[model samples]
Target: MTGRHILVVDDEPDIRSLVQEILQDEGYSVATAEGGEAARKARRVRRPDLILLDIWMEDVDGITLLREWSENGGLPCPVVMISGHGTVETAVEATRLGAYDFIEKPISLAKLLLTVERAFESERLQRENVDLREHAQPIIEPQGKSPVMAQLREQAQKLAQHNSWVLISGEAGAGKGTFSRYIHDQSTRREGPFVEIAVGSMSAENSAAELFGAEDGETVNYGRLEQANGGTLCIGDIADMDLQTQARLLSVFQTHSFTRLGGSEDVEVDLRVIATTQRNLEDEVAAGRFRDDLFYHLNVVPLHIPPLRDHADDVHELLDYYIDNMVTHERLSYRHFTVAAQNRLRNYGWPGNIRELKNLVQRLLILGSGEEIEVAEVEQAISTQSVSGEPTAQIVPYDLPLREAREKFEHDYLLHQLMEVGGSVGKLAKRVGMERTHLYRKLRALGIDHKKGIE
Candidate 1:
């Protein structure tokens, strides 16, 4: 699906028609504007992947248009200037205003095609190499007030004072990447580039060249290490790195320098590294899957991320946070979770951790309707691909943590009272000597349905 839309803005009807027709033939979705005002209107309607703007337009020149856009919200996409009588001074000014490239008119069709292709490719690569935090809202406070999480944040802040490398470990989707960014953002070098590379996604043949730049004759490709110079480089899924790459990385850690894959000169960098793993690195080292040297080096300041279930109390806050996130970023309609629905979710095992919870919120927003999400809706949602493939709430184990054990006893005590009173919550509450509202909340927290097995 080459859904790439290009906006062509020029006053001349003939040139616009010719360019539009040619670009359309090349499988691009092309939109044309007669002049500056039309270009503005077209851009308001939809953001373009690339804009071909003429230097001399009837209403406004391309330079003024670029200036306006830069001031407003920065250029929405790359803009390439086209001028038949373009002077070097004009080209320099256009470049200064953030024009991707200059295309002199008597436009070389071959050059035009190549520039368009290269612009898209460059943009794609830039997005991939930049910070990997998608849907990046302010991290706000750590939503978890659980002591374990608070101490973890404190430890992160302490370790951030130094430029020492860090290794973050957790289950998949347990927010290892989140803590890495928190550490980076808190560190002294926050203003510098914070580049990230997904090591697991790279191939064995390309991994070394990707981590360390490769030079081919006159052409040189700067890799993640060079890109992250003077700042933090988060090597995501570091345990997935191949042995050869691990050795090369160890060399870089030993000496803050590496030669480009095909070049002779050594490039030195002032770098801080943050590596994340969802697996036990020591086990990997013993299995000969990962290098012992690399393991020790990364474990210098290791931070362990607790699973979502450990601090289950935070689930309510996380639910609110994600709901806001979905509404603000994903444009999903807001839906309130009923007290009973929230309680059911908090007690869930959350095998997939925070990532799973976020997905669940997104799913409820998309698939479920109405203003409030009740407990039945939650049960229906979780029932599909549930842990046991059954519609059941998790049973609290006999040897549960003290907090959970107390909750379990309260739930059973109230449930038995409710049943004895013939499934009437009002009668059960009066018999239990508790306020109606507070007892209702307690019943919900325990996932006890007073209406169950009643005529």
Candidate 2:
């Protein structure tokens, strides 16, 4: 923390020396500039942590220099405008021109030190946000506008306004996954990577490989948590992560750092963790499957996303939105659902939620004839239950039978949980009945290695 760089911009040599001595005694690295051009050049070259600018310069006045810095948009350091002759109006102008704070000259050592510290802290936060943005991926788009859907959007937007950990709950088939994306998109950290992981998708053995990220064939790999640094990490399926894995994860969340399995040296990440699950976390915690402390931490901002069946009024808008997207993507003629078809869709229980709905619409657009989709077509589609209606294929009992069935089951279950949980293994293992270590062993045996889903 020592040797923090400070740039003192002042035409008066006496003032600059006094300030430099004071700051250097306080363990800061001080640089002096006599004029606006020199200050700008120093800023470009060294990019000091903070700048103390004298408002009454002989050539270009401090306020003028401040405005120039603002206009250029490359002012790397936070500027604290200092002056002996500056008035209230000058201070205000300096502030408006992007000065961090105004400091009156004949400066008190205490006041000046406090203001400088505040400026440095502000600069640090801004830099962290920039680094986070540079590493993050773009937010996924969310579309819809029915009253209920509108309310959900509003809720998601409100939640994104803060930096708290969010726990999104919804039954399977609900739009929790989509809502997670919407929240991240609306957040200030939107530019950061939205590294999503389904907690239940990887077995305890593979969970390490999947979430923390292990290298190929004993090489170095970046974990999901590390990759998501400075952005949002959406962990899906809170219920599947086993106790041991959850404990390890809890440690990471507590410390904000983690080391890959079979690796030395810890990696740090700053992220807004948004997790989703269909199962109840309280229930999982009570059942001794999830760590209670972890639950409390994750559940700080709980959001219950209503299932589509409960928000029937929003069905038509969703239908229209998906239809339009399909038409545009496929370069096909425009299409709309008939009134009767719309009614049938609304009445039907969408157990699979928004994803199921989107898939259905895409299927209809691909298979249906004519410009208008009819009630009969929708009825046929839903009745066939073509998407979620069918049960997942059961894994064949492997020949070894040495935990093969359980291993296969774990593999399939982990993948499903990962998909449903959105890449949160801690949540996933809690959902399934097993320890994370056991799950990992199964994952290794089954060979399940995947990355973020490509949208």
Which residue runs of candidate 2 sit more than 4 Å off their true CA positions? Answer: 1-147, 214-219, 386-455
Residue 35 of model 1 has an lDDT of 90
CA shift of 242, model 1, Å = 0.8
What 10-residue stretch in candidate 2 is worst by lDDT?
A: 131-140
Return the top candidate by lDDT: 1
RMSD after CA superposition, every candidate: 18.2, 15.2
> What's each prediction's clash count?
0, 46
lDDT per residue as tens, model 1, 241-331: 9998999898889998887788777776677999999889999999999999888888989999999999898899899998998788556
- The superposed Cα distance between candidate 1 and the true structure at residue 84, in angstroms, equals 22
